[model samples]
Target chain A: MKKIIALLLAAAMMVVAAGCGGEQSASSGSGSGSGGKQITMGFSQIGAESEWRTANTESIKQAAKDAGINLQFSDAQQKQENQIKAIRSFIAQGVDIIAFVPIVETGWDTVLKEAKDAKIPVIVVDRDVKVSDDSLYVAKIGTDSVKEGNNVFKWIDEYMAKEKKTPRDGGSQYNVVVLEGTVGSSVAIRRQEGFKDAMAKSANAGKYNLLASQTGEFTRQKGQEVMESFLKSYGPKIDILFAHNDDMALGAIQAIEKAGLKPGKDITIISIDGVKGMFQAMIDGKANCTVECNPLQGPLLMETAKKILAGEKVEKLVYVDEGVFPADVAAKTLPERKY
Target chain B: MDMLKKFAGSSLFLPVVALLVLLVFNTIFVDGFLSIQLTEDGRLYGRLVDILNRSCSLIILALGMTFVIATSGIDISVGAVVAISAAVVCTMIGGRGDGVAQMPMALAVLAAIGVGVLCGMWNGLLVAKFKIQAVVATLILMTAGRGVAQLMTEGQIITVYYKPFEYIAGFLPGMPLPTNIFIALAMVLLVAVLMKKTSIGLFVQSVGINATAARYAGINVTLVIFLVYAFSGLCAGVSGLIESSLIRAADANNAGLNMEMDAILAVALGGTLLSGGKFYIGGSVIGAITIQTLTTTMYALGVSADQLPVVKAIAVVIICLIQSKKAQEMFDAWKARRMSKQNGKKTSVDGKVAEQA
Candidate 1:
C-alpha cells in the first residue's frame, strides 16, 4: 500500500511538471500567434554564469517581450553539446529563426549545415562560430574586442597627456602588468593584439614596459591571486594594470588595496567589460577606466530579427559601438547603464 | 645499509623521492624557485609560499580521499560538494555589508559544513545500505551537485564582501601565512590521531582489504564505509569554505572544477593504492604540495596557459612510470642483466689470463 501510494505521488508530481512546461510553451506560442504573422525566435544562450551573462539573458527576454515577438529560450549552461542540442531542437520545432551565443568556435559545422538544409536563418551573438558555409548564420552581433583593448590604451594616452606626463617627451616611464583572460580564447587574443597595436601607435610607446603578463582565466579569484603574485614579483615598480574584464579589475583592486596602494591612483587600472561592478569601482575611484562590452544586445538583435523576417537584407556582421567609460562619467551614467 | 634499504622499501619512499626530485628540478630549471621574502605587511611571499598556500584546499581534500581510498571506495562528488558548500555560505551571508558578516559568520560556515555532512550521509547511505557501486553512486551527486549550487545561487555568481570571511583563505592581521594552512594542518593532525588512537583505522583497512572476510571477522564494515564517505564529505565542505572565502564569491560552475580528480591523483601519488588498504595522510599532504609546486613552476616559467596542461600531462606520465610496479620490475630485470653481462666479461678475461699464463 505504501509503495503504491509513493508511485501515485511521484506520477502526480511528474504530471504537474509536464503541465507547467505545457503552459509555458503554450503562452509563448499564443504570444507569437497573437500578432499579424507572428515570428517565433528560438535563442540559445550560454547560461547565466556571471552577472554580465545574467543581464544578457534578461535583456534578450525583455527585448523579445517588448517587441511582441514569441521567443523560445534555451540555456546551454556553457556547453557546446547542449547548445547544439538546443539548436537542433529549434530546427525540429521549425522556428522562424534560430540564434545562439556559441560556447566555443569549432564543432558546429555539422549542426549549422543541418540548420542550413532546413532553410532556417541563424544569428550568432556575443561569440562567433566558425563554419565552412557562410550562410549558416545570417549575421554576427558582438563588440570588437580588439577595439575595446585599443580604447584602454587610448584612455591611458589621454590621461597621461592631461597629467603632462607623456612618456615620449621625457616625462614618466610607466610599468604595466597585464591580466589576460583565458589563454587562447579569441577574445583574449584579439584584446592583446589590439592593445599591442595601439601601444605601437601611441607616442608613449617607448616609455612603457610590460613587466609581466599572465592569464587570470577571466575569474575574479584568479585575477586576485595573479595580482598577489605580481605584487610579490614587481612590487612598487608596477605603474599600471590592464585586465581583460571587469571581474579581473575588481579582483586586482582588492589585491592592490591589500598591498597598501590606491588602485586607481597608484596603479591605474584599465579593463574591458563595463559591468556594473566596474562602474561602481569607477564611481568609488578604485578603477581608472573601463571599455564597454555591452551585454544588452537584445533590443538591436530583436530589431534585426524583425527586419530579417520582413525579407530585408541584413549585413553579415553588425558591430556594436561600445565606448570607454572614465571615472568622471561613471557617476552620471551609472543610472542609465543597462548592463 | 640495512636502514637505507628499509627506508627505500617503505610505502612512502616513492612519494618522498618524487617530491625531492621535483624540488631539485624546479630549483635548477626555474628562476627564483626557492626565493622567499617578507613584504611590508610582514606576509611571507614567494613561489614556495604560494605552493603551500594554494595546496591547502587540495591537502584537505586528499586527507578525506586517503580514508575513502583506504576503504577501497572513491568519492568523486567532493568537488560538487565544494560548490554546494560555497553556495550555501555565500547565500546565507548575502553580501550584507563592507566585507562585514551580516549574520554571525560562524553560523553561516557551520550551515555550509552541515550541508556537506548531509551530502556525505546521503552518499554513505547509498554505498553502505543500497550497495551501489561507489563510483556510480558518487557520480550521481557529482553530476547534480553543481546544478544544485546553481539553483541555490539562482544561477548568479554570488560575490560576498565580508572582510572577516576572507581570513579563511587570506592572511589574518599580523599573520604571515594563510589561515587555511593551519586549518588543513589541524585536520591532518586530528585524522592522524584518530587513526593512531583507535581501532577504527584497523577496521577500515581490514574492510577495504576484504569486506566479506572483515564482516565475518565481526568488524562493522558498513559503519566503517559510511563514516569514511561522510568524513570525505566533511573535508570537501572545509575546502569549499576556504575556496569561497578566497574568491569572495560562490561560482557554482568553476569553484571546484576537476578538484576531485586532483584529490584522487594526490592520494594515488601518495602511494595509496586505488584498490585500497594501508594509507598515509602525511604522504597525501606532501603529494598535494607537489602538484601545486608543479603548477606554480609552470606558471613561473612563462609557459602559456594552454601549454601548461601538456607539460603537466608529460610530468604526470613520468611520475606514474616511476610509481608503477611493472616499471620497477622491468628496471630491476635490466639491472640484473647488466650485472650478469659484467660478470660474464670478467670470467672471459680471467679465462684469457689463464690461457696466457
Candidate 2:
C-alpha cells in the first residue's frame, strides 16, 4: 500500500510539472510567432486606490495592447514589499523590460540591482524611486508636481488680468486661503513651494494676503470641515480659495454653497488635478480653474520602451504634457476626459 | 455639594467635562464660535452645527462599539464594514445620467444594512464558534471588506446624483438642522431602551466578565457575543449611509478610513474598560462629541495640518489623565494629608493656649 501511494504522488508531481512546462513554451512560442519580435514587458502597479490610478492602469494596459507588447502585469496593492516581489518574479521570468510605479520613493536599491544583474532594463513610471545607482532604472516618467503648482498661480494671474479683477494700486487687499493636501507628502510639499514662488513673483504680489493655510488631508470631508472654519474665521473677506487637489475643492464648494455664498463668484476657487468631478464642478460654475496633472502616460511609456529596446538614447527624465482647464472650457472638454 | 459629587463620580462626567472644556476654549479664543446663523435655505450654519453634524456618524459608531466592548470584544471591522455598506448602497442605486435611483431608496438602504449584518455574522461565527481571537477574526474582515467593496464598485468611486438621496446627510425641506443629527439621536434612544428594558445587557455583562461562569449561570454566551457584533454592523451600516451621502459618492478607498480607531478611542474616552463589563451609552455619545469638538477647535485655530495630530494627541492625553481613577485617588489622598496637617496645627494652638492659662 505504501509503495502504491508513493507511485501516485510521483505521477501527480510529473503531471503538474508538465502542465507548467507546456504553458511556458506556448507563451514563448506565441511571443516569437508574432509579425516581428514582440517585446515582453512586466509592469507592477501600485493599486487602484483612486480614479486617477485606475485610469493610469487602464492607459498602460490599453497602450501595451496597442503597441503589441506582451504585458505581464501585477498589482502591488499599495505595498512596497509586494512591488519588490513582483519585480523579482519578473526577473525570474526574464522579461525584456520591467516597469513599476514605486509606492514610495525609497527602498528599491536591492531589487532594482537584481533586475540590472539579470540585464532587464527597468522603467519607473508615475511615482519615482530613489535607488543608490541611477542605472538601476533606464527612465522615469511622471508629472512635475512643482510645475503643476507654478502653473496654478500663473493661470490665476492670467485669469485675474483677463477679467480685470486684479486689485487696484490702493484697493482693498485680496485675502487668499489655501486648502492643502496630505501633509509631508512629496507632491504636497513641492506644490506648496511652487505656489509660494509664483505668488511672490506675481505682478500684484503685495496686493494678496494669505489669510490661512491648513491641510485637508486630500479628502472631501476634512476639506469641508476646514473650509467651514475658515469661512467662520475670515468670513466673506476671503477673495480666493486654493486647494491642493480637486477633491478638497469640491468639498469646499459644498461648504461655500451651504454658507449662502456663490463659490466661483464669491470666492475664486482654483485647485490641482483636473478630475471628472472637478470638471463637473467647473461646468456648474462652482469652481474656477484646475491645472491638469495628466495620468495618461501609456503611449509615452510604450514609445520609451521601444526606444530603449532599439538601443536608442532616451531621456532619463520624461514628463507628460498637461494643460490648464478653466471653467469656460470645462463644458467642452468634460466629454473627452477619460479619467 | 453632595449631588455635585455624585454627578462628578458618574461615567458621563469626564466626557461631558472634556466636551465643555473644548467648547469653552473655542468660545474664548475663536471669533463667533458660539454664534449660529440661519441660512437662506432655513438651515443652521455655523461651526457648532458642523461639529454636531459631522460627529453624528462617529456617535452612532461609538454606540454600537460600546455594546461590543461591553462583551470584551473589539470590532475593528466596523470601518471596512462601513465601506462595504457604502459600496452596496451606491451600486444598488446606480449612477444613472438622469440622476434617478435604480432602486427604491428604502430598499437600497435595507440591502446595505443586510450586507453589514451578514458581515457581522461571519465575524461572530469565527470568534464564537471557531474560538478565534476577536481581533484576528475581525481583522480578516477588516482586510477583505475593502477588497469586497472595491469589487462591488468595479474599482470606481460611484457618485450618487439622486437629489432625494442627498437628504440622508443634507437638510430636508425647511429643516433647521441636518438629518444625520436626528438619525444619531434615534439610534442612541433605541440602544438606550434596549439596554434599559431587556436582560440582554445583563447577559452581555456576564459573558464579558467571564464566559465560563456565564455558561454555568445558564447564559447563552455565544448568542450574546453574536448579537453584539451584529448590532455593531448595524451601526456601521447607518454610518456608511450618512457618510456616503455627505460626499454624494462611495469612495471605497477612503470611506470610513481609520474610523475603527476613532470608534475605539471614543469608547476608551467614555471610561469603558477594555476588558469589558458595565458600559454607558451616554458616556460614549459625549465622548464622540468631545472628539469632534477637538477637531473643530484645531481647525478654528488654524493649526498646521502636519502638527494637527500632535496637538490632538496632547489634548487626548490630558483628557485621559483627568479621567484616570488612579489620578483621582491620588488627589484624594493628598487632600486628606493636608486636612490632617491642618487639624494638627489647630490642636497645637489649643495646647499653647492651655499652657498660657
Candidate 3:
C-alpha cells in the first residue's frame, strides 16, 4: 500500500510537470513578452470540418498575429456543448475578449449571461446566437444570407440577357431547381426565400417556373445526390440550378455532366459562397456565377474587438460587404480571392 | 384462439404490427400515400416507392446489425466503414470534370468492398482474438474512419461522373425500382438461407447464450464471432456503394452520419433483444422501412426539420413501450381481471339458488 501510494504521487507530479511544459512552449510560440501588456483574447472555433471553415480559422489566426493580440483558441468540432464549455473556460481565464462562431442558433442564453456577469465582452462571428439580452455580444459579424441569395439571381438575370434568352422579353420559358443548405438553418431558410423573392419580382415571373427545391444540407455529396434526383424527376426541363453554397453547385456539376449535359451551357448554375474551388469551377466554365459570402471575417472581427475595448460603441450587427462574381469575371478575381 | 396466441408469441409480431400501424396512419393522414404510379420512363413513383427506395441503405446496415446483435456484440463502426468504402471507390474512379471515371468501374468497386472486408476482419480480430469489448473496439474506427475518408478524398467531396456507376443506386433501364432494392433483397435472402440451412445460426445462438458452454459443446465460438463481424463489415461496404452511388460522390463529413444508431434502432424495433440470442433478419428489414415511413409521415405532417426529431423520439418511445414485456404483462392482467369478473357473478348467483333449494 505504501509503494502504490508513492507511485500515484509520482504520476500526479509527472502530469503537472507535463502540463507546465506544454504551456511554456505554447506561450513562446505565440510570442507573449515581445509586446507591451498584450491583450489576451480567447476564441472558440467551430472545427475545421470543411474547406470554408479551415479558411475561416486561418484568417482569424492571421488577423490576430497582425494585430499582435494574444489569441487563445479552442475548437468545438461542431458541437454546441463544447462551444459553451470553451466560453466558460474563457470566463475562468478572465480573458479581455471572448469570440466564437456558434455551431447552432439556440441554447446560448445561460452561457452568454455568465460571460456578461464576468464583465468580459463576447463577439460573435460567422453565425448568430439567440440570447434574450442584446448586449450578450458586443457585435455580430456575418454575411447577409438573403442579400447573397438576391445577388445570385440578379446575376442570373444578367447572364440570361447577355445570352439573348431573357424570359422577360418573351424570349424563352425556363425552369429552376434549387439545392438548399442545411434544413431549418438560418442560412438555408433565408437563402431559399431570398432567391424566390427575387424571381417573383422579376418581369418574367410567371414565365419562369420554380420546378422543385430540396434541402441539400449544404454539403457536396448531398448536393450531388439531390441533383441526381432532380435530373431523374425533372429531366431536360431544368434550365437553372441555384444552390445555397458553392459546394452543392460543384457537386451538381458532376451530376449534370454525368447526364451528358454541359453544365454552364445546357444548365446555368448559380451558387453562393466564393470558395476557391468555385473560382476554379468558374474558370473551367462548369459553374456560371457565385455570390461571395466571404469567410474571411477575422480582420473585421478583431477590428470590432479593438473598437469595443477603446470604449467606442460598435454596431450591434456588422454586415460584411460582398460581391457577385460571374464566370467571365472569375479569371481576374481567381488570383485575388481570399477564401 | 390458439392461432392468435401463437401469432402474438412470435418475435416478428410487434414489428409487423408497428409497420402496419404506420402504414395505416400515413394512408389516412397523407394524401395519395397509398397510390403508386408508373412514370413515363418505367419508374415507380409515390411516397410508398420513395420509402422503399430510401430504406435500401438502412436495410442493408440493419441486416448486418441483426447478426452482430445476435452474437451479443455491437459494431458501431459500420457507418465509418461506409465512409471509407465510399472514399476508396470515388477516389479510385478519379473522376475530374463532370465526374467521368478515369479508371475502370469494376476495379474501383471491388477495391472499395475489399477495404470494407478488411475493416470487418480488423473488428473481428479485436473482438474475438484480443477480447476487447465490441463497442469499445468498434468506437476506435467510428471516430477515426471519417478522418481516414477525409485523407483519401483530400478533404474534398469526391464526385463520380461515371454513368455505369449510377446503375448501382439508380433505376436500370425498363426496371420500375432502383437496383439497390434488388441488391438489398438478394443480401437478405442470402443471409436468411445461410443462417437457416446450416448449423451456423444455432452455433451463433449458443455462443451468445453462453460462450463457455458453447466452447464446451465443441462449437468454434471464436470463429463464429469473427465471421459475424466480418459479414457485418461486408454489409456496410455494400451500403457505402449504394450511398455514394446515390449521390455520385463521397462526402467524408456527412456520408453516413448517425447511420449506426439508425441501424441499431432498426434491429431493436425489429424485436431483437440487446442481450443477444434468437434473431430475425426479415423483422429488421421491415423495421428499416417503418423508420423511413415515420420520416415521410413527419414530412407529410409539415413538421419542421428542427422539430421532427422531438416528434420522432416521442413516437419511438411509445412504440418501444408497446413492444415491452412489461406492457404485455399488464395487458394480460387486464384480460384476466375482466374474465374473472364475468364468471364470479354467475357462480355466486347459482350458489345462492342452490342454498335456497
Q: Pick the candidate with the highest DockQ.
A: 2
Descending-TM-score candidate ranking: 2, 1, 3
Comparing 2 and 3 on DockQ, the stronger one: 2
| Clash count per candidate | 3, 0, 1
Q: Interface-residue RMSD per candidate?
A: 2.7, 1.6, 5.4
Candidate 2 positional error at B287, Å: 0.6
Flag regions of model 1 displaced more than 4 Å.
A1-50, A57-123, A129-132, A163-173, A257-262, A302-313, B1-9, B324-357
User: Where's the lowest-lDDT run of ten residues in candidate 2 chain A?
Assistant: A20-29
Model 2 clashes, total count: 0
TM-score, model 1 to reference: 0.83
DockQ of 1: 0.30
Off by over 4 Å in 3: A1-49, A54-142, A149-271, A274-290, A296-317, A325-339, B1-10, B325-357
Please provide, for model 3 over A221-330, each residue's C-alpha lDDT reduced to its tens digit, 9 standing for 90 to 100.
Answer: 66775676676555568888999988899878977865657898888898998877787788988988889887888789888998988899988999878888889999
Model 3: per-residue Cα lDDT at residue B322? 70
Work out the TM-score per prediction.
0.83, 0.87, 0.70
Against the native complex, each candidate's DockQ, computed on alpha carbons, is: 0.30, 0.54, 0.18
Q: For model 2, how does the per-residue alpha-carbon lDDT over A79-193 read when each residue is reduced to its tens digit?
A: 8888898888889888899999999999999999999989999999998788788988999999999898899888877777688774322356778899999999889999999
Worst 10 residues of 3 chain A by lDDT: A20-29
